[model samples]
Target: MSKFNYVLNFSPDTWTPSMESKAEENCLGGIQNFPFAPSMKIDRLGAVCDFSYTSYSRGRDPKSSQPDNQDFHLVDSRPFPKTKVRYVQRKFQKETAQAYHQKQQQQEKAEMLLRQGKKNAKMRQAGTQQYQYSRHRFVSRMRTLTEWSIEPLSSWISVAEIPLSSLPKQFLDVSKSTIEDIGWFGTLKSYNKSMDRISPKLPMALKDFGNMEFLQPTTSDDEILRDALLQPEKNIDVAITDQILACLVAAAQSKYSWHILVTNVDGKLIFDKQDGSIIDLITVNETSAEPPLPDNVNKNNRPHLLGLEALKSNQNYTQNIQINGDEGIIKQFEPIPFSEEHQDANVESKCYRYRIFSLPPRAGASSSENAQKTVRVAIRTEIDAQIPNAESENSGFIFARALNEYDPKTVKTWNTQLESQKGALLATEIRNNACQLTKWATQALLSSCDILKLGYIVRRTPNDRESHQIISVQSYKTKELSAQMGLKEENAWGIVRALVDLLSEQPEGQYVILRTPVKHVLRVYRIPDEESSELPQDEQSHKE
Candidate 1:
């Protein structure tokens, strides 16, 4: 057997051995041929001693001095030598107590205010209560309109003109123009053919009713405005533009679920409509007492199809008249790139006129420093055709639109009713096509167009859907037409200003002002950057 020399130190004050070393030694002794050496090395290890004890008498023991029975009491005691954990616990308790007391005080104060017949005070207190519990998802309340005194700027200054070169070169005027002579406007034929080409799977019967093609702006208004503002020579800072303003103005009357995308880029608010948004589609009988049925159920009476037909008719009518009219009266702009199919044209009739209007600050904000910063807005308005005599100051331009009747049997004949019961017909139309007429009036007012010409066209026969004949053309002053439609320009402007101010309060980010379905309420939602692309897709799905 091999003997191993081991030095062991057993000093309680200074000596300690790790558990790993102890385990290794134990394993070595068990596996190998090592025997324990019992040597009296007092200096290397430690000295051991034994104690001698003396016995004590039971009568004189320490326990005999105390009482046989003892009483105990529980007492709350503070921790000694305060640590970070104890300090934090005390701070939290103090804050909780303070908050409880403050809430109690506010409740008592609110009750007192309510009992004192101070209505305004109660309202303010209620607002405060709501504010404390409000979350980010809670929509801000719209401002109450106590007075409708909004007015447009004394004069509007022309900003810039977007050319109409891209528009098909054709005369587009309906004044003194008959539909029979024009032969259904060749544009509709091409538009319908393109629709058919895209939807090869659609049934042939569906093609005759015209596919429900909701015409939307090729480029979003937001993108157009952004690009327009980028021009070095055109430096304009506007809180809101016409597209958003128009939506806001007509919000109270809108029945559809539409949303406006608002992006605050570098402190500038850009209002945009999503791609294929239904908001751009001209609605037919949307606000009527007996509105048209859904497109899926009624093929011919579909609002979208009717609106598209009317839109195409108006476009064709305006282009033809402008093309055939005097060349000197036509307003021309720098030509833009045109499609090969529409390259052969006499002149372009469509032109965009940009103007700026200064909106007054909020009512109560007159005393604030921000009152000096009046809200200025820019609008891109369109002109369908110039007045026959452009030199006349009374009427320099006119806005024209056509209202088509698919079946005169359902309603009164336009030719007879328009002359005898014109007022009744107008009233009926107001009830049925409230949204369409409102939009037309809004557009005309935005452009300050002199005249609004409405053409009444009906199909040649009840069975014939393609061929239509114009019965009569009625023209009204823009302001008079707005009044007839019960549109309060002042109130519209007020709504626009209020919405602009409300949106301006939000931080720099993207927000959506969604008109809730089945409710007249508009809710605001913030969109995360990652999910921003999904908004347009969502809108498209809704459209489909």
Candidate 2:
């Protein structure tokens, strides 16, 4: 027992005459050993069986000096002490350690037998090997599943019970996540971690806690284990499996951590966990971002047909959407929105302004004045490549041209189509939608790792005069700042000037990880917050 249990002595009259003497009779008798110690007796099963109690037949009046301090009275001294408990626990743990050792021995023996290679023992060896392999794999999987630092963490039970008898049969494949499924996740995890916290305020007496040292009888722990929980064999379930697989894919594809948007068939972002700094506004499968969809695999989930082999659901939805008005919806690109938190966590501005270039326009009223309209629309950030700009004579400009020049009616119409069936349609239907051509064209300059090989950093050094001029101005900040300073942009001379200025003017003992478009996410973890006016913590005055 983790704590002691005994009847309290209330008022004097509360104790019946017969109960007075009998209080001590059965009170400590149930306790097998009086002062349970390591050398104390234990059953053959290696369990410490002992209990102690101060029984009182009735309550005592608080004001009364003392009626009689005879049979069954509470003592003030701390009854359970270290020497006794440490000994008992040592014995119990010894047995547990022995069992663990034996299992290890058996596993190694099986391994040796496997290596010998005998005809008669072949089948046995094979079985042994499989068992060993499976156990090893299971342990590895659990480590990954829980993200636990210790390999034996799963085995480190708090000894809640001996025989988990109350477990249901249907609960064999049951796992930690399933137990969490019994309620919300994280709740049960914290609850079980609090074992002995329940108390007198608990409206009832509880587990062993007093200094009345004795090994906890296995039964109490058995009760705790049986009543407290079900046997959890694993944590990964179908949904968790999907998430883990997705993480592996994302990790492979991304240079920096990105946020994940989990949605159901409706495509609304439901679960959001951002890794690095990236505030990604979430939208469900290009539809209305609102009430989340219910999770039902069979009926509604329009599984994303990711990476060919995945989600090969040969259902009727694909064929159905092709002939229906939903053809364009099936082919749209679903960009995951990231909602990352950080002052400057590599956030790409969503509203990138694009300038229309039309023959620099004729200088007359006949000319369409707004023809070179600067349309500033919010677009999703490019996950793979920096979309070239026309000014660059490379990618961003060309990409912008295609996007701005697209048929407004088609774009607006298809956008409407996405919103209409936001939740009801299948994922396949959305993919094969009529906009497949538009989607492909947009992503063409992106990571067309499969087609157009047009995305990577290209470095070119400047010529003599250009390099000399830029280097001379070398020092400060943004290109805009350099231009304002009237420095030549011929060869990054302004950039050099900006850097030199920043080095001299910037405060000491500060670090910065600044990045702009065309640069990867820069994670700058400041070692100190110099801007804060708070005095040093160590300088606080201490009361004498």
Candidate 3:
């Protein structure tokens, strides 16, 4: 018998066996008997082990070196157009079948729900019409109810109980005729004419109350309404009262279909109507007990509001403090440090301070005597991480020598001076007021400069949040001017900041072009121009 044994070593080391003579008797004659020593052919397994997948068949073209049927198919098979997986056949159509079933079920459910909704809608409409009719009848009986001397039901009467058969034993009483005089304002012929008359009177009233330019030229009745809703405490002024009445009167007389909304001084008696048929009444009764004080009343309820006494007491008259770029002097403002009872490990705490410069004389002071007199009020500022620009280090706090000297950059000192119940209330007020003033000033500035085009710039902060910036320039010249200013067209935020700084620092009466992502061209106007009287430079700086 003949046998072959082989050993393979993949290692790098090579060792040679010592020279030894084979025993003549033991030596096999198998190799001598074979003519070519078995031809030394490599089998399929051996070829695979060597990583050679090529075929050795000679029947195919010699030039075609492909190994397997796959390679031949790839090289010579007819091309087929690509198709989506859904179009192709699969063993299990689980997803496709499930999607079809879900869609059918959704359509059926939607149809049923829509039918039910239509039925409910019809019922609701019928009920609404019935209620409105009954309400009209009940209101018409107001004259009869008053003549019978029956006490009026509270305004909280449920609509369900408003019967058409007979008037309720009790009905809301009407007060003295305020609406009778409302029509006496003598209706104007056109809305534009009424607006023209009321618009001029609004500013005059504001000025008469020593509030210079408090109301913008385009101040809308809606804005006044919104302010009354949001800042009730701040609305307790003669100017605001007159402004509201004037706006309401003008709107009522206008040709437009404006409905009247009546509410008491306390807003408890509130009602609205379209026809102006009912006269809602507000009155005080001697027999009724005084309204109870609000359960939540506190001394600092409206710390931002300045009553006549407070305003008179803190009446400050000073000159504008030139902005000193000296950090050494500015840093001398050591206001009381901020403190928190429960500080969080994850929350970052940042402190800021704002100085309100050139507060036009208290709302009712004569501007003639105090034309040059200005007052600076400083308040502590805090930025929560939640706001987009809270992390920004640029606090934009302006400083002047004539400002109230009680610690300009300190939160605690300002809180003490303002007699704030909570340290944070005044800060909120300052931010709100600043945003309001900025909105008005921007509109006025754009109008005064006769520029209709403006650009809005925005950028993402480190936290991946966006902040907005306004950039004004001459129309359609952003690209050309951007090149002149050496600004990158893509770096929108940087351009806006640089341009704002440049324009603010420039001398008055000079025009500059600023580029933004917006397409509108804006004419740049500084606050100190002829329109300076409309918005003070100090207020403008605070807004900026």
Structural similarity to truth (TM-score) of each candidate? 0.54, 0.16, 0.17
Q: If both were scored by TM-score, which would come out higher, candidate 1 or candidate 3?
A: 1
Q: How close is candidate 3 to the true structure, as a TM-score?
A: 0.17
Top model by TM-score, which number? 1
Count of backbone collisions in candidate 2? 59
> TM-score of predicted model 1?
0.54
Best prediction by lDDT: 1
Task: Choose 1 or 2, whichever is better by lDDT.
Answer: 1
- Pairs that collide, model 3: 152-171, 152-172, 153-171, 335-410, 453-521, 473-522, 475-521
Models ranked on TM-score: 1, 3, 2
lDDT for each residue of candidate 2 in 1-544, tens digit (9 for 90 to 100): 5444675434465322333455555555556665664342313212212123232222244533354434557768866655746888889999999999999999999988777757546657677777788789777644322221111222222211111111111111111111121111100000011212321122111111122211111211222222222223421111211122122222211222232222221111112222212211111122212211222232221111110111111111111111222222212222212212222342221111111111121112123323222111111112111222223412221111000001112333323423354233223222332122123222221211112211100011211111100000011122332233222222121121122222223233322222212123222212244422221221101101
